[model samples]
Target: MITRDMTALRAVNGGHALLRAYDFIICGGGTAGCVVARRLAEGGKATVLLLEAGGSHHVPAIMDSTQWMWNIGTERDWDFVSEPSVGLNGRTPPMPMGRALGGGSSINGQVWARGHRNDFDSWASLTGDASSSYERVLDIYRRIENWHGRPDPRRGVGGPVDITLPESPIPLVEALIASADGQGIPSADDINTDPMEGDGGCGLPNVLVRNGVERVSMATAYLDPVAPLPNLHVLVGAEVERIGLRGSHVGSVVFRRFGQRYEVEVIREAVLSLGAINTPKVLMLSGIGDPAELASHGIPCHHALRGVGENFQDHILLGGCIWEYETPELPRNNAAEFAFFCKSDASLPTPDLMPVLEECPFASEVTARQFDLPVGPASAWTLAPGLARPKSRGRVRLRGADPALVPAIETNFLSDPDDVRALIRGVEICREIGNDLRLAGFRRREVMPGALRGGDLEMFVRNASGTYFHQSCTARMGRPDDPLAVVDPMLRVLGIEGLRVADASIMPEITSANIMAPVVVIAERAGDFIRQTHGLG
Candidate 1:
């Protein structure tokens, strides 16, 4: 149901005639898209059309944060698969993404981490835009999030999304943090308290779930709050097929809804918030990618931008680190209640590795697919150590012109030797924490690479590593002089008028933490740019 909020952006579309024109057409009403929609439509100033490819986020199983694992690979997921890589022993990996209104926020682990200061500052430096500086992004974060746990005025208070530190952490988590401390990793009260200062050691996860059960996502926070707005029309189950280009600007966006095709004329502009994977695919499908690549799929090149689908980077973590605790306790929200970041090699600039502390037997996907796992009383905790900022990059290319067909995603995980070495250090750090006396009571023993070291461990990483689901930089926003920049520092498509790209895809580089927070910040700023550009606000 399209919410009818009159005070905010009035969004009421009754027929095809009403859909003929819109001030803004936002594609992919997922994580970042929802934010863009609400902000743009504020005070009934702009008629915004938000098209989500999936249905609403009312699923009880999905809304309940604990049932996140069940949503993966299900209908609610994009279910994109990566190409076979030598790292996984020629086995392709499954890349599950949220397909509904709130996007990944509806089905993710709810860990809302706003990466380190270096993350955003680096983007500001790369794009030569002070608007994306860490200080500006931090203020935007305060506006986007409603801190439920702490009353830190520094962290926004009455914002939309409800973010909180872990609730009633289990004993095992305490032990793990202590163990991490023993390994020279400092203890962090929270990741958001000052990311640069609390950058590493043992840290608590700032989750999106409130009161242990209820979830807070873009739909619940941003969209639903302004549901009564008449200027904001949220069309669910509307998959944008291709963006029709005009002589000098975008003419219309063709989408399919309920088995019927619909084309909405873009009066002002269109924003792509289709995430890292689908964003590039949509660009390529719209004849905006590399000339040769688009031609290969029989897609006529309208605006040949070679960097549209290139420079794809994702955080791939080797889940080979595991442990079976005899009586370990876990959190009510998600198993991964605690975490820490560290530089595997001090010579590296920032922390290149982060170890996620999950209170369960988390083995490789290969093991989980063909093996049995225990839960709660029958289970123990595991340390899933991963590389933080990977140097290896990949791409998503169109397989065909069909909109329903997914693109071929190649993450190229562990392709960089430096990335491999970083993960090695992560594993070594985990081993150090696992054997520390602080967790002696809960540590049963290493479930993977029991006694193996050196080359054997490297081989284990090749077979056990998987994506952290933090994919970014497919439609990277870079310097004007850089030939590979798909979008400018302002997030406007390089050669396309009436079009812009927001979301994780526009990130010049992936953040050092979970990407949800950064996505919100990007959308917040994007909304500002749009309003300022078109004189809406």
Candidate 2:
């Protein structure tokens, strides 16, 4: 039998030679978890331990920007499946979120749009915290990276994450810009500015790419530097089953490695960055969810908070219109432009209508399953939008106590009549834009079973509209007055001490833009909140 020294693994309850317990234990070293780890470890005051459920982020598929998406369902992704949706004709689609060291940030399209200022301020208003304020969150956003080396006061400079326009080599992106411009859609130089909603922007799609590689991922930006720190440790391929509790405080986490279960104690706090799906599952499994639900599954309840898995919301993206351009050689490498528009053409009192982009297809769609749609020789893309600030909320519940079984995610899309109307409007607008004269030279005709004047278009939409993958709202942050609120304003779990949820799950509402950049910003701010509350140097 292979064995090690017993003393080496033994814990020293109280001793001077003993390494201090981590000031923070971050689970799911993903987009936000990485940022949180880095910010806390920057000054070397707090000990940080980051645990990731997946394997390494150094996979070859992660480096190649175009093929990065291919890594989704492979070992790198959590491969979570949502509950069958009645809204999308009872189809249960797969939600491929990165389960690796860098989490979804490493495998995503790398778009770096920061969404609207109002998105943050709305969150702040809900939480009653100034840090959640738009201006405060904007400061955190600017602190992350240089925005394409420009001297824009709005963009951050000299940060770890490198933000820039997508490099050429993906040419369909460029033609999309030209198409939008020809249609009189206004081009935005800065998509992250306050009140970010606009008609259309000609600027290149901003990305978290650096030196021809994905850089904004937490593994690259945060843990890469402090991983060797004596106080900080990272475990890969570790699946957390539940958090161990004592009275009302989270005492430790029980996880599996190599078919053996191990428990790691946390002296300070345990932060859950397990994304939307797994975060709620962990809470439910740990007896921190609804009492009745736990009792039905033969699991005990630690806290009977009903909001643990409630408030689930994800964007619904519809793939429509294939444009085939007749060119001697396919344009392989060229920069792409972007356009953001209000859902309604009419003006809003304060832009309450959170409709953002119409073209360039990165954040524009979060595909639940990419291969489900039929592909052909001509470049096939989608025109996607979901009601960004959706009024309807869903839930993530447990099928059983088993962590291996994926949680039941009910993404109540188009539950609101207005959201359905918005999708219909989005489809109509995308068709109009695709059929414009500017695209006449580039596109041959619609290849799908749909036509300009047929019911097949409706059939196509019914069959094809898929999940945008921007899942959030479970364990949401809100004031004590709101019954649906899971976490309090301080990012702390209600009725539980020394525990927090610091990823997309805590977002009061999903942002209109791609979530990677915003998730990082959220972690950055959360790091500060943790430090200040704990009085860390």
Candidate 3:
């Protein structure tokens, strides 16, 4: 509880202390939430209150970039599960969302990527707002990044998140890169640059580690640096029960902290940054969902906003092409050192497939369960090929009216057959990239999924495919005419005042890259929007 406590100095109606009102109340202390808190409270412009349902991010596993894999599915992660899907032949995968201060950014592989330029352009076109175009969003990206590489037009310095390339110790990684080069895919100097030089390039992955060692999550980069602000209050371990809306306006939020219930007042507005899953869940629990659905849960409907928990999208990858390594080696920081982006089909405007080469045998947590995997070091490595722009869509709905229970997420992965074709192309690309002269000595033999082709390969994709941990668009911002549009171009809830969404939930569509970078840009834009509307000091 970082908020100043002056309850003993004042008493309100019925012996209660003042409701701890603030000019802005930002919910969820995750990636974007922390940035909003810092920007709003900077220079004491506005009295800000940031509430997180989780605890401090002081755990060593979370602080250490290389140890992030250990935190997944632990108390640090929300450990949510997907509903059974035919896509995986009726497998329910567990989602590793960060239940700690930094949200998914903390639990995710520390890869730092801004995605392709066309991905954000697609978002702008959907919203019909030029502000969301890649050009405008790029400025915010520049502002948020503090790249470890030398200064350039594409990179920025002295920013919150310090992003750099992590060292790769394995010989398999260089062999893979050389193989891709032999196939005519050159290196990308600055992948984040607009019209990326290597839009079709394959190389080592850039990471969000500070000094190439520690994880520089939003908690460490944004909130911790601004912790001294007198007007800023960050309440940790405070679970928000529901948002209280009074006549289409965000009134307050009811929460429980340390076994005591509290009602926090919002002087001006409330921003929801609870990621894709919880943001929609909160809206539905607060009576802002479909009227019929709300009544089924014994909750009166505040607004019949049917789009609160729909249009869910996640990155699903066909599990790796594993090969035995000649010597013992292990992944240090950010499991996957090499990454690739290329077109599955040239007809598409941008690359639709990405292959992430990891030093270890990598698979989504769920995929690891269905098949036999080698455990010993130097045994095998993987080339996990992913379908970046999937046509398949899913949904996130409330398990019940209770905010404590994890919501039911129906990923419905590979429901669209187009995804299968795209992934098949990725597999072919991986095979092409793997069969290079550089890899002749290091890779002894193909292990998992070896000697499998066509039908067998397709079956492998169905059983092993799972998320890249980029869940988004449950409460997207879009054009007014779009029924699925829960928020406007500026991220304001369609029919509600004094409420906005500034996280992955508001993304009309998920970007091609890990969502951490895009979410930061969105939150930075949101901070500007709030100040413009309410005149923050």
How many angstroms is residue 215 displaced in model 3 relative to the true structure, after the best TM-score fit? 0.6
Please, what are the lDDT tens digits per residue for candidate 2 over residues 126-170? 888777887777688778876774467777887787777655534
The positional error of residue 310 in candidate 2, measured at the CA in angstroms, is 0.6
Relative to the true structure, how large is the alpha-carbon lDDT of every model?
0.80, 0.67, 0.79
Candidate 1 Cα errors over 4 Å, as ranges: 1-18, 149-153, 195-199, 328-331, 367-378
Largest lDDT belongs to which candidate?
1
For model 3, residues 365-406, the per-residue Cα lDDT tens digits are 545675567776446778888888888999988767766778
Residue lDDT tens for model 1, 100-181: 9889888888888788878888999999999888788878988887787656656887778888877777777788877787
Superposed Cα deviation of residue 332, candidate 1 (Å): 1.4
58 Cα displacement, candidate 1 (Å): 1.4
Error of 2 at 345 (Å): 4.4
Please state the error at residue 119 of candidate 3 in Å: 1.7
Candidate 2 or 1, higher TM-score: 1
TM-score for each model: 0.94, 0.88, 0.93
